[model samples]
Target: MKQEPSYIEALLPILTLVGLLTMNVFFFEDTLAGSNQVALLLAATIAGIIVRRNGQAWARTMENVVSTIGSAMPAMLILLLIGSLAGTWLLSGIVPALIYYGLDIINPRVFLITAVVVSAIVSLATGSSWSTIATIGVALLGIGKAIGINEAIVAGAIISGAYFGDKISPLSDTTNLAPAMAGTDLFTHIRYMLYTTTPSFIITLLIFLVIGLSYNFSEAVVDVANVKSAIDGAFNTSPWLFLVPLILFVIIIKKVPPIPSLMIGTLLGGVCAVLFQPHMVSEIAGNVPNYAEASYIGFMQAMFGDIIIVTPDADVNELLHTSGMAGMLDTIWLILSAMVFGGIMESGGLLTRLTQPIINWADSTGSLVASTVVTCIFFNTTASDQYISIVVPGRMFRKSYQDKRLKPEVLSRTLEDSGTMTSVLIPWNTCGATQSRVLGVGTFDYLPYAFFNLISPLMSILFAYLNLKIRRYELDEIPVEERIN
Candidate 1:
């Protein structure tokens, strides 16, 4: 049997990691580019080297790294598909149509609330916060800016809504990941999550409502009409633009696996672009005469290449570009770096070592949830990736949750609240990096406005203290083999 790691040994690696990554964040804002990932790999290597020095086989340590990353491969794959889906979906006019329609429906008087609600609806439909933000979120932010809303407030509303859908949707990896790690089924976990999630959702909507009611609707209408006309003139904007998104959502509802579903959605989008927006594709390919050839070449390149759309206006120029697969490289690099740190931690037994004190002292359920919340924040600070934030703390805290007679869903839910939602609040984390890339907003600039995230940790802690909807553990609720596993 393998021995567990000591607290001091586990903690030193994390402390070193946190100190270095914090400095990296300060020096690099959004520019550290994979330096945070490098920091993680170095920290994990240090942990692995320690175990080897103590006579643990280096091969065994390496194997643990493999297993740790192997488990997360599913999530990594999902992210890739999501990136591709965004590109092709944009090509098909699904996203543009959503933007045009969203701009139409969301009046300025209710812009903040509408922003949150619309982001939630689209992210749920597509199962992607990143996509939702990059497309419609960008459009809304621009619209909100034109309407005189606080940029931070608009960014926050966008993130809040986007994440709400991402958290609750059956398609979200974090939703699936939480359950996978906590010994629960995906649907079971999601259903259980509704308890806490619904309350948080309601509270968030109410807060946005108050903010939205304060905006001037008439001024927004004039600004919005200009944007709508501009988008319509740019592409053949029609009600048909919505069919692609609806089809994508339907495939998800039919229980199509996210990878194939997104792939199908992307292809469908490209086809839709050819049929509905031939002029747009032909213009993009610089071949106004050969529309069919232009559309095919343009769509295929768009699936695999960097394509920028230039409008007569500068702001529209920023809005009209897609890197397709190239845009996802930085995120993939960050995920890989995060996995190395996780692999080392698992191999060294450092994760277990780190969780011991918190587990040993967690006599109350409230403390247990609080501990998990703290651990998540620690990983984002130290490990510098949301993947590690979810994975490491999840593995460390699972047994503690069971031993305390609390259901695994509690752990999963708390992990999402603290891990997934708060990740963008930290500038070095992957979620932060991606959001900053997508929205053109600084992490520090929007941190205060991400009210749902800012409040979720406290809300989770409070639930723990009040014992609200915290499910009790039941041994008979699981199978014997599962118990042994």
Candidate 2:
């Protein structure tokens, strides 16, 4: 006896959520911690009330919310592992070695460009933009500050490069998830993405290069040697420490599952800490007489708790801390809250109702792609989670793309172009909150500089409008009855 809710009822929850979020942002500014989570819960409750009034059982709605949150368990586990990996890597000398080496090779004039390139390389190898930002991204931020560069610009370049790699890397969850949701394979999605991704990345790199070269170093001389010395003194900076990341890369390249790969990487980081950074581990252990016991205590603490590595240099000290798995809880909370809201909308048919108008307006291939992009962005803004943004539009548009004789890769690429990249641009989204906490940069402060993210959706639309590489399946590949003229 379930009845569909009216369009106004469907729209009310979204409007309420938006209004609350705007007020939260305006009043709290950078300190709007947990406000949006509350907003999402309130929105979900409002949606539930409307759906119940329309004859949908409250039990069924709660069931959908639980099921939706359950589906996100893998992502939650990955977030925890990433936090553990960051802690162990910092304790071990792997992260310090990277910073020490990166500082040595980079000149002030080219530092911004180098930051982008280095971040891109790391994210590509690990297939994790979050890990890249938490680790090397933090060290680069310190280095940039010491060299008199704007922190906001540094964060922008770092994010731009990290997300570029995340978009294309086979090991990325979003890359895998996008294709799975859009009815395509991972490699095919990546291959199709290159048509727009490559050009956008090249343009982004060129812009960073120009910005790097324009920096005037005479006014603010960087003391690279001093920073290196501090890092070396604080940890055992050596090339041997790189074996940890090398093993991680090898496991990823071998197509091992991400959870296992990150677990192995975390364990390797602990071993490296024990072997190469015994003194630091002992210090973290605090009063343990046995080295073996100290190593155990140190590694356990780093895996599950928080640790701060104090250095003589104040700037370097800020860069040398990790909150382990506990730090990821806030982000996990945000994701769960968002899932509840999205689940309510989905179960109530609100998302379908909201998306119908946009889908109906897609008369041509170009218009179709544009509408998909806009829908993805809209979800990112209103849904406040990247995964929801991807999943919802992807589900809504799958049949539309197939009906239009477009390939599944087109839908997948559009999801990533608008959904994945734009998530970090919004202050209330889970990606934005996690990254801002990790990199110590606000979303708005770095939004203007994330050139790759800003350009990706536009690039997708441009390719569609220009009829460039918009691959459709062979006419014979379509069913006779379903094929459109």
- Give the Cα error of residue 272 in candidate 1, in Å: 1.2
lDDT of 1: 0.74
Which sections of candidate 2 miss by over 4 Å?
A: 29-33, 108-112, 118-198, 210-223, 363-369, 376-416, 419-450, 462-485
Identify the candidate with maximal lDDT.
2
Question: Each model's TM-score, in the order given?
Answer: 0.79, 0.76
**C-alpha lDDT of candidate 2 relative to the true structure:** 0.79
Q: Pairs clashing in candidate 2? A: none
lDDT of 2 by residue, 415-461 (tens): 99999999999888767877898888999999999999999999999
- The candidate that wins on TM-score is 1
Tell me the whole-model lDDT of each prediction, alpha carbons only: 0.74, 0.79
Model 1 lDDT-worst window of ten: 476-485
